[model samples]
Target chain A: MVLILKKQVLRRLITIRSFSYDKWYKVESERQKRINKKAQDFVKDKSVFDLFKFVTKEGVSEFKKFVQEFKETDNKNYKPYLEHGDFDYLYKFNTKEDIENWLVSSDSGYKIGKTKASLNLTQQNTGLFSGYLSSDYDKPEKSKAIYTGYANISSLTEQKSFKRENRINIDQFNCFMLKIRGDGRTYMMVLNTPSKYTLTYTYMHMFPLYTRGGPYWQYVKIPFSKFFHASHGRISDKQYRFEGLDVKSIGITCMDGVEGPFSLEIDHIGVLKDNESTEHFAYETYKIPKYISNT
Target chain B: MARRLLTLNLQLTSLNALACRRLLSSASNDDKSLKKVEKTEEKILQKYLRKIRPKDEEEKEEEERKGPFKNYFEDEERNKSAIVFYEEYFDKNTKQKDRDNFMSALEAFRVTNPTKNLYLDFIYGALLKMKEYNAHTHLEAYRKLMEIFPIGPIKCLTKWQRDNMHFPRHQNCAIQILEQMERNGVILDEDFVRLTIKIFGDWTHVVRKAKRQLYWLPKFKNSNPYPIPSIEKLENMKDIEIAFAALERMCMSADNATRIEAYFTDDLEEKTKDNFESTWIVTAQSQKQAELLKDHKKSIPIFVEGPFITWIRSKMVEYFVMKTDPDPEIIEKIKQNENYDDLDQNFKNLHNMFNDPFRDEFSKNKKSDLSVHELTDGTIFALCCTGTGTKTSLFYWTKILEKQISELKDFIIVYKIKPKPSFLVDLDKLKNDFKENQQKSN
Candidate 1:
């Protein structure tokens, strides 16, 4: 009886093992079927759009020629200052005497600390904004003792073309390229719009010097879309978009809180108009009102 | 007897021979019949096995045929077949899943045929144009293609990185993939983040949005704990003071401040601390200026050079310091009770008072009636001086100090100049004596 019982147990075990094997095989085959279906579907879908075509050399030259033609025929509306290599409108502080007419000096130490800034022509006759910053945390309890030195392309002066009414039409340009040499410190490019009877808020773009402590010149290209709006040293919650024509002034500031002397050299500043430029407003987060309804 | 025995033996032998012959005949007949039955059973078993085995064999064969390519020749054949499949099924209504399958198959082909893989670029271009394709699908196809032919997609990404320009749809798709990867707990490399930023961070709006989303990514948040405020939240805020205050709150959150401090270098950390301190001082100064401006009918020159400004600054500091410090007695009482809901409500009230002082004063007054004794002397002074009635201050104080003051419910707390004399000593005679002394001096 014991032998018979043992034989029965062996037979049952064999049957269970076979049953599990069959189940596993079914699962694997089902998975393979799904993968096969996906593979087959992938082969069934391929088409190309016109935008995928690479821009060739001839295409670029042709586009430039077209832009030139557009400028020449439409001279009154189209002004290509940098495209034609026109440096007449470009602001250059070639000598110490010329600095007064072209730029205004601002330093935070004048009010609280002992920060001083000087603008001098380089030995190479290039425009330079150099400054000494000191942090005096002892004078007042609430004093930050920070010193900042900056120079603005004064729009209030005798240059009528640089006035608020005669602002450059940025809609026709792609970007502003500045040839600058700096000492690795971060710098800010500030632009202001014309306001009546009140101080206008400035829009600023802060970028760091790619190379530091070297005399090598770096050409920095800043698009108008990169500037963020600020008023009185505070970032604004609302960003107001203005056309290139609306810009009244441009300036550069360095205030990284590194207590030492800093220097920045300027070679030239100009605008470039490239057809390949993506013109859509880069910031898509700003809300746009659907309609101007009278309340 | 011998004769009889021999005869018996002969008889037995004959009987035995007869029995043996009969047994042999029967056994042979039985064997023949058993053999026929066994052949029929074997034939039936073969038929049953044939019926069940074909289905499994066909499935196995199909899988083997579609499995990974064995050699370059097989890969080439598969590629050609895939091309034909694509050409045949290429239509506007072709589903995204079908395109993905074809790309995957081509990927498998490319894996086997690694050299001279030019067909992938064509497929990628075509996939780029498909409206049904999104960032995830595009990413999957790109990744598979990369696995087989790593050079193609890398080259494409490099070109896009160099030009710093991408179609809006492509850019959006890349952002979506990055977000999805992050959501799945995948830690993306810095290069991926940098590439995404390069492609989409050009516009102010995109950068603002990306900054918030990227800040939460494990890579960004782990490295830098600063909470990036959303542009919508910042833009909707009308007051700069309130906005900066909100920023301060975010910076000071328990999970963030320590991590952010660790992220900053020594010098940067010092500067950041100074900046925060200065911001609070500036806020306090501004609040004082606003309060002063509100009191006078005419505009006043609040920025007096000498001691006046310093005095105002000191006062502002004092007010802020007093306002921020919670009463220890009340805190102890709250801790003892462990009534967290009441504590949270009290904190809410404090925040409301900080945000807007006058909008819901009446409602606050009604709520404050039950808890008035918690008011510190300095708080009462500030409330009265600021023209928020004594009753409101008492009410606000009680809410915070309810538990502490419950024992003192029977006592009426008030400011007393001097204790009343036990007996009435001032009489008309004392007044007359003082008057006579005054007359004598005159």
Candidate 2:
């Protein structure tokens, strides 16, 4: 089943654009192997029916619809939306129901011991992502593995049809803005953008979100150009500018390695074009010089 | 008696036979038999050695019995425990818990425990005590702590030694010190780099951690938009003074029209029978927000919400906001005034409106660009962080505001206070708590 999905995504990628396909395919396969290895550490093997425990009945229908859309749609009709000229909220946490739009998960659920994280509304009606992060892991028998702590609150990815993601086009905006109250901790805000490869070759652009913890709500304006592409927690050597054409979701991750209670209260998230910022991309997109060659 | 002697003689002869078999096995050089003979010989040798070096074995047993740490409180005549020692050395020796005293404590511990047996315990203990002395933020304390570990010998010299984690416990402790320094937002200097290299060598993990700190710390040190004063300065300033600085930062406006007002609670007209120490209230109001407060309807009640928390560095300060409910009529007007920012949505709406002859209303021109100030569900008038987050204190806040905006006198203000539970209520703390408890019981 996973193989079929992989082929479908690869086909879509090849149809849309051209690249060094063989090299990317190698990198993607290597990444998939690493993921599978990590997954195997927790469970011996996952059968096809075991996948149903995660993918619901509705998910199957969604996949079917996605396949149908995949057949019909092309690069021309991909995520066509009017460009936002002014500030508009992508996600607003004004009420209890608004908090439901985000899904919270942590390493604890994957048999990692003791760490717990959750998201809920505070008395002030803001979404409070709070929990204790513990580094202690329940060691499996004869396993030489170390489990670190990580808890993330990710916004749900919307799918219009059989589409992988109902991409929100905010190309007109330059800055991603949010109002948040945090406990003086640094968080990583990861932007999920569509890539030409499989899910393994995820194009995640992340930037540090430094929060000044206090009573006052801080309005942070991070330029989209500041985001640098990273996959599997490591930045790519060949960097590229962040194109906000098909943004799917944003994830806020807390993994500072501090073992204690943490909290982040979010008011709203939006996008705007800051007139002051002149730099197109914070990091250089040119290929880094390699001193050594395999040949 | 004869039968027992015969049995003893047979056992001695068998021992001789085994010794003979060992000799024969060595001569023959048969692999399996030679291996079996060597194993028995090793067992006999181990038994012989145990008997020979009984004192050395006893000393090792004694060392193991003491566990991972040495008991510094072994001197029972004076009965000075570790806690008492800390109190005497840190508290009684110096009244001021400054960097000097902190270093002196480390010096004193080193002098007393010269053997440095289980030094990791001492380092861990010192780390816990450093927090109480506020020495966790001091670079000198970390330097002193790092200096406590004897250098040179523990340093991993070769690549193999570095890879295998030579002196792992000590290296980890050093990394932990660096981590704590990072946590306290301490910027490590070049002098510290030299010290780390000298102590742990260039290739050691401790040096790598220090190098990482040196690289990353400077980048994020000045990144905070609302930067607080140094811990040294904050340690000296009063709570109210700190609150003023924080409130000033929080209420900082781009136009520079935000006015800060401070007054003592004792200055209020309403006084209680029992006079206690007065607390200061630091309130901030912008000129535009003050104008909005004046124009607010007298019939509509204003809400003073929150005992919200904001951190001025590590110190927590509770604050309140005075705001009016967002009127739906005004919200609707704002909505009608707002333009569809999406070009496609505007085009579609225009097409629909043009096609229908009966539809007369077109997209209205945007009234004004929506600023962050208008993004709130409620219009905030003023903000304040007070020493006491009580209804009476908030009422005094309104009374103070009434002097600035006279129209506030006619408005009915409602306090939505959810103050944190603290011990200090008044001079007679117990009595009021008892009364509140009784009221709750009813």
Candidate 3:
């Protein structure tokens, strides 16, 4: 069925007149987004519908309102906090250290971990199945959903020089693919005194569908390695006292490692899972009135 | 009254939001066997993911799990749990027939059910690019669509009425809908007029939102009416405005964002090639664009889309001129014909006409009971007067005309009702004459 569609569209393209190119291009590109990618991949293989297989650094072919990135000024309480104002800061990150210092902070007794009030046990509300995401859990299986829990540093409002990011920790299980959105380096609209941004993607774990990164509203998927590297903790130890870098606090940060109101909209956040296991939905996936997907 | 699409047969399953929750988070299991990359260091991670997939789904249903910490979508399963809730709602709550009906009805695009309808009252705008009475089908589609969106129709009607000071009559469906909402008292005076316009053609809106929405439509997994442009008729006429009414309707909308796309130059299927910025109106319904085009600098026309610009650059007008006039002199006539100074004026008239709050010129020229309908027709006519790659200005059929003119006796003076791109202008002749006059100085 899909093959017939491919033939029909290509045939039309062959004969389309000179100017309709834009409109045709619109439909065609959108069409390609819809069926073309899958069909082409299918040609590469018989039945390749796996989401990861389709993640050609090219993202999934679906649109959601959440994909939109907005300036922090527009609506303060909007979902999906900004990693930094305008997606540009990350392009300037000169080294891993620069990003690390900016991403992780020490808040006296409040590192970037589960609040002292809440134990790592995940207050009943923060369980993996139905938890609110314990701050203590950087693990995907126990997430505060980066908006609530991610690289946090101190004194973002006032900065003397600059700060580097602590590496992210893309654990082995995380299927995040590190996909770049713009000319590989996204341009930031807002000004960063330091003038740089370092961005790493979490790949094929069906991100973009989840994290919705940055202010420009582009898809970002990172490899587990990049994810971990971008989110990893700093190591500080001497014979006297060794401490694994745990985020006690973070303020507004940009990729340039600036202060205050850093924002990032992760397009999707999931480590790639290699599976097409036909597990029946706990509730049968069925159609609804006029709209919606079946589980 | 005459519907373009069939009535939507809204079939809803019991809204066991609870049962739906069970299905929502737990649908997919973490299958380790399927993902045997055989690499080890990562195996530990997969093992962890497997343990949490379903457990997370179950947890999402508990009232405590969702609201507070839902923002942290760190992994696929929980991320899937929250984001995929809508899909889950449909899967568990709906029936197989309803799914098929939803899929099939998308073709008809008419709202069938009053409740549980998925895409109700959602503002829908299409640059029909198709002329003739049949264009009214879009109206019916617009009307029905207004009926279904979560809060769209009622909001549209009330907002329309308040904006119009009464129920909108003789206007595009959007205005009419706004008026209807007012009469129905389904919405408030402060309801966002812009949003209502996006759904219908209020003076402030254009269907650009719909265009952007459709632009991103392909990104969804298993979207209903997957493989958009499902029907063959929609295939070629994707963005072609069949008539002035097409654009007029969208222009009449209250929302500034009316999605307008330029038809590509017929051959480019590549994204990089399609990146012409002069085209594609990112700034929808902004007065700035209309103002910019009037400047002597000949600022890029905001309405002109990238593909259209490419079309102009493609020497398509040259192609048409060659075809429409085989005589060198005749081709010269079309080429020599300039619409700039006066053309700019004409463009102004059309712009003012299009920008007119009442769309009076459109109302005057079009054959319609609704002023909205008439105004929409006028806007489309203006576009047709320019170029749209079809029988309009780009002259897709002009190649055939060229063949005919070669055979016809008096083909030198073929006049195009619309202006086309000009290449090899007679301005060269003026340059030559200027040189001759300069020789006298020598």
What fraction of the reference interface contacts is present in each model, in order? 0.00, 0.11, 0.00
lDDT values for all models: 0.41, 0.69, 0.29
- The CAPRI category of model 3 is incorrect
DockQ of each: 0.01, 0.08, 0.01
Model 3, B181-295: lDDT tens digits are 3222122222243445544444322232232233232433232210122222342452333222233332333224434433333432333653322211111122322222222
Q: What value does the lDDT take at residue B295 in candidate 3?
A: 28
The share of true interface contacts that also appear in candidate 3 amounts to 0.00
For all predictions in the order shown, the interface RMSD in Å is 31.1, 15.4, 31.6
Candidate 2 per-residue C-alpha lDDT over A103-141 given as tens digits, one digit per residue, 9 for 90 to 100: 888886767556677788765467888777777765443
TM-score for every candidate vs. truth? 0.28, 0.63, 0.18
Superposed Cα deviation of residue B252, candidate 2 (Å):
1.2
Which 10 consecutive positions of candidate 1 chain A have the poorest summed lDDT?
A: A80-89
- TM-score of chain A for the candidates in order shown: 0.57, 0.68, 0.19
Across residues B327-433, which tens digit of lDDT does each residue of candidate 2 receive?
A: 76666655554333335755322111112223323343434443333433667788897786767667677878988888887888888776542212232577888
Model number with the top lDDT: 2
Please list the residue runs of candidate 1 whose C-alpha ends up more than 4 Å from where it truly belongs after superposition: A1-89, A108-110, A137-156, A159-171, A197-211, A240-242, A288-295, B1-442
Write one digit per residue (lDDT tens) for candidate 1, span A1-295: 9857865885587578663333343466679999998877666542222223324544465567656656666555644333322112245555666566555455543454445565667665567776654443223323332223333334333323112144545565666767666644556676666455455544443322232222234556666665555666544545544456656666776554445556677765666554455655544444534331111
lDDT of 1 at B188: 42
* Model 1 chain B lowest lDDT segment of ten: B305-314
